[model samples]
Target chain A: MRVLGVDPGLTRCGVGVVEGVPGRPCTLVAYYVVYTDPADELPLRLLHLDTELTRLVAEHRPESVAVERVFSQHNVRTVMGTAQASAVAVLAGARAGLPVQTYTPSEVKAAITGSGQADKAQMMAMVTRLLRLAEPPRPADAADALALAICHIWRGGTRARIAAAADAVRQRTAASRTGARPGAPGRPGPKRQGGTR
Target chain B: MRVLGVDPGLTRCGVGVVEGVPGRPCTLVAYYVVYTDPADELPLRLLHLDTELTRLVAEHRPESVAVERVFSQHNVRTVMGTAQASAVAVLAGARAGLPVQTYTPSEVKAAITGSGQADKAQMMAMVTRLLRLAEPPRPADAADALALAICHIWRGGTRARIAAAADAVRQRTAASRTGARPGAPGRPGPKRQGGTR
Candidate 1:
């Protein structure tokens, strides 16, 4: 599956696309940083971000999008801007009819480097190694975005499969408790006639 | 000027429109709450909000839009959702080519009830009285949205005028420093050359 990962920011939003599945080597399709002037008004900055991201999504056509979730920082202003940038990324993904996922910084680190508390240098080394690039992506944000895409491909797909399996098990348990045959034609619970989730 | 105010939330987003100038009685053009199912996925909820807010802006065609600036809350999850919703609201305004402003909750409260620490009841009462509504708007969020619109109408315009006057003073100072005419054409620094901002 092709995944587009976004490391969202107001001044510089990092975007990277990777193509791969779990347990396989992923290829970096493209990477870029969208820049906006801080001197511009907030709405204008957001408009620029939205326009650039939508353009990138249309060009890349990724199956899924992964965005870095904004965590609380000591600077409320900074956090607010990050959150705004994240919203635009998520909205762009949704607008393109792609499933969007968010990974926290720790989650991305754990998935890419097998450690929740991995530092920036470690992350860059691991990302460089995994993508088989000659060197690390510059500007740190680009590496971080590429790492996020790799993490989603490596770990997010597996997590989703496990969660789906658990859900199926839960459904079976509920059906058994209610004395209904599994996959019955017309019991309650999601008719499954022609509805798409 | 007509203003559309938005009190953004994940579950129930409040939207209201008011018409008036500063130091004048404002009329509530409309007030409502947009609800999203908690069980729905995050992207779908945000999509709904974006669609609805965009529709509201198109139908109302307000001169400006006002959004509640989300402050840091004890609950990180709740604050993130609020911030996301605020982003969508602000984006809607920008997309519609309306100037968007944001005010803190305490600022709205202070503008409406004459105290930053006013209770909900006091805010509701003041909103009702100011808008000439026979009774308080239901669900509190609607009332808060109206109060936000009124606050922007009553304070934001004055604030803008003050800011513009300050800018003019700064420009005059700069011109004096460089020994140029105060309002000379093509003299750098916001030449008033059809730049809307």
Candidate 2:
């Protein structure tokens, strides 16, 4: 499975992608950032973000999108800008029909480093270490984005899904021995396809 | 020059890229809609978007990124989503080291149809006609992203800059004959340089 991770920011949005199944190490595919001038009017800034995001989505074609959830910040303007940039991300994912998932900063950090309070540099190092990347992903934002996606795959149960799917098949065989057909009206809850997901 | 326009949204983000010099109607290098599941948490969603955007930017290598400016909408939730998505875009461009530009929805509409209030369908039609695409861009949102890029290129003064630069050269020639040097302490006002913006 392929996952795209984003770190939302109005002035600078970070993006990263990793492709792989869970339990196994994730493959680092790409990472980058988008920058806009806050000095510009809000609408224009959003528009610029939208256009670039759209282009990027079309080009990458990921199966799913992952983004950072905004926690409240002290600055009103900063929060507002962050919120607006995040919208552009959701918009991009939806427009492309890619399943989008978001994780809070703490969650991503915890999943990657076994700690939720990891600082930006710590998160980056963990991302590089966890993914076994060639280097610490340049531009901390991009690494954060990568960490977020890897964290989602880590959380989303890629490995468990596979195991569960196999167990589901095994259960179906056992049911078939007793003459129950798959999806046969009330036949023990449809055997949970796609694995306990 | 290829310019990518993006319309950032949490539900649907639009992407379109026009490849050509200013004044020359651009070709739609690519277009698509990105979608994310509504139930996902915001951070995971952002991560997903970031990953996808990085790949796209790397693939397209657009010289300039054009995106829509966010607007104040009545619904707070809706506005919040839009804002978040927009931030992802800003981050994407910055990471790529590409110059990013923004336009208002009204600015895009006005450029395409001579009206700031042009509807989506109208903008799509005009964009298709202007860009000379094989067909109207899909998902309406993608068309919007494309239109935003076109609008910026049309009015971005890229071509105008070329002309302005030529005129500056002419003025400098004339001034030199009369002994006026730009960027140097002069008999009149402060001298200007023709080189660098």
On TM-score, the leading prediction is 1
Q: Which runs in model 1 stand beyond 4 Å of their true positions?
A: A73-77, A156-197, B73-77, B156-197
Taking the true A–B contacts (Cα pairs closer than 8 Å), what share appears in each candidate?
A: 0.68, 0.45
lDDT tens digits, residue span B1-197, model 2:
78878898877888887876566677778876777667976655666666676677888898878878776542555766676676677667766877777788888899889999988778878988888877887788888888988887787766578679867886776577447554464445334555544
CAPRI class assigned to model 2 = incorrect
* lDDT of each candidate versus the true structure: 0.87, 0.76
lDDT of 1 by residue, B23-119 (tens): 7778989998999898997789989999999999999999899999888753766787888899899999998888998898899998988899999
Per-prediction TM-score: 0.79, 0.52
lDDT tens digits, residues A1-197, model 1? 89999999989999999998886778989899999999998889998899999999999999899999888753666787888899999999998899998899999999988899999999999988888899888888888899889998988678767777777766766666456655565465532222111
User: In lDDT terms, which candidate is top?
Assistant: 1
